[model samples]
Target: MKPWLVVAWKEIFESLRDRRTLLTSLIIAPLLGPVLFSGMMQFTLAKENKDHEQRVEAGVLGADHAPQLLLWLQAQGLKRVPAPATESLVTAAVRNSQPKIVLVIPADYGEQLSAGKPASVKLYVDTSDSDARRAGERLQRLLAGYAAQTAALRLMARGIDPSIIQPVVTDEIDVSTPASRAQALLGVLSYFLLLSTLVGGMYLAIDATAGERERGSLEPLLALPVSRDALVAGKLLATMVFAAASLLLTLVTFIVALRFVPLESIGMSANLGPLVALQLWLSLLPFVPLAAALLTLIASFARSFREAQSWMTGVLLIPTLPIMLAVVAGLKPTSALMAIPSLSQHFLVSRLLRDEAIPLPEMLLSVGGTLTLAALLSALVVALWRHEKLLG
Candidate 1:
């Protein structure tokens, strides 16, 4: 057998023999993604159902001035409560009471409507509160409906068609499929999948490098006639294998767990079919070597196993940043993004989840870019191993 292959086989055998390693790297890590994702989705769905079924509570100041408007709000399922005595007290009342929205009808509201003049209503809400925000949106929609009705009545009184005042009618068509619509809900899946690749081979990489040194086995292994590059290549290959396995397990576990998730309850569907799983796995394959090489390089610099583990904890957080930024900034995938390593994998997986076709050029760019990076990092790891301090 080739030296690298022999070393890889030995490492795999050793990792399998250790129950703790197998449990953490293989079983627990893979299962965690699916379990965590499903749990969160379930909780969100429950909260959404509860919110939808509950009535929105609102407070109205100067209710007598806008009796018709207040009645319209009540018809829309807003439970009216006594408003705060002063405008400045609205915020405090909303924060302390169950009312999420307050409508302040001005004292001049009835006078303005009676005189055919424009009047404004003030809406007080705690924008920092999610429930208040939702209530505010509902109130805005109701106010818009009331305004449209009043406008129509005024046009009728003037013997003019209401359509004449509104010259253009806009129609909005949503072309997003259920899978695409679910992208927002499933966006975190990319983070979890990429995280699996980082964590899967972490322990094995640390054990192969710093753990071996701490146990005094690295010096004896380096004493062998095999080239230093071959030794590093062997370890790198083993780490990649474990990482690949972890990525596959994570995908499979998540796909199975998604089957039990009631996605339709949230008006989203995750089509995690076998083909999608295969595509996701293949799309992330190039990243396996990159993750392995990066972990091995970092672990090689550590003086002890615990220190290597500590460094890896922070290193693993790197891949999650791109995903978070993409979510926060609402970033779209472009050809330029494909050149980034972890970010590229995240974009591709997200596209696959959205059931969008990836262009051939984009796929090539991502895969080629990741492999190029892995090759460069592997060379660095080999160069580092050639030094005496690395073995020490």
Candidate 2:
């Protein structure tokens, strides 16, 4: 066997023998994302279903002033509750969460309606609260519907055509497919996959370098006849094996876990069938070497296993930063963006999830950019291994 192959086999064998390494690489790292995602989706779906079934209750400060309007609101599933007499009290009640929202009808509201003028009704809600905001939005929609109906009736009573009041009407058309709609919620899958890939290789990377040094085994291994290049190659390759395994398992686990998620309830469906998974795996394959090289490079600098773990924990967040920034900036996949490493993988994975065809040039740029960086980092790792201070 070649020198690098011998070293790689030895490292791989030892990692398999260690229970901690096996547990992390085979189980925890791979399952973490799927389990969390499943639980979150389940909870969110349950809450949304519950919210839909329950009637919205809003406090009314001057219910007597708008009896007809109150009846209309009640018919629309809004339960009217007794509210405070003053606006200040109603605002305080909403802020205190006694009621999520309040509808205040002014004394002249009926008079304004009788005179054919716009009658303003105040809706008090705390915008900072999500539930309150959602409730407020529902109330606004109901109010708008009521206003439109009332306006049309008034036009008919005046012997005028109601449709003439509105010259333009719009029919909304949604062009998004089920898979594309799901991508809006599942875009974070790329971040999870990238993180898992790095994590799977992290223990092995640290074990081969900082761990061995701390255990006093690295010095003996360094004294061998094999060149430093071969030793670094073997270790990096071993790390890549675990990282690749992790990446694959994470994707597979997500596929299985999503099966129980009832995504159809939200009108979204994942396009992660076996063929798509294969495509996704291939597109992400280039990232394995980059993750391995990056982890090994960082671990090689640590003086102890604990120190390496601490450093690599922070290193894991590095890949996520680009994905976060891309989401925040709402960036589209451009040829220039494909030149970025982690960000490129994110875009590619997202495109696959959206059932969109990736341009050949973008694919090439992503693969080329990732592999080039991996090669540079691997060279740097070899240089670090050759240094005398590496023993520390």
Regions of model 2 farther than 4 Å from truth = 44-55, 115-117
Model 1 misses residue 200 by how many Å?
0.6
Candidate with best TM-score: 2
Off by over 4 Å in 1: 43-55, 62-66, 81-88, 95-98, 106-120, 324-334
* Model 1 RMSD, rounded to 1 decimal: 2.8
- Note the residue pairs that clash in candidate 1: none
Backbone clash total for model 2 is 0
Residue-by-residue lDDT tens digits, candidate 2, 195-227: 899989999999999999999999888899989
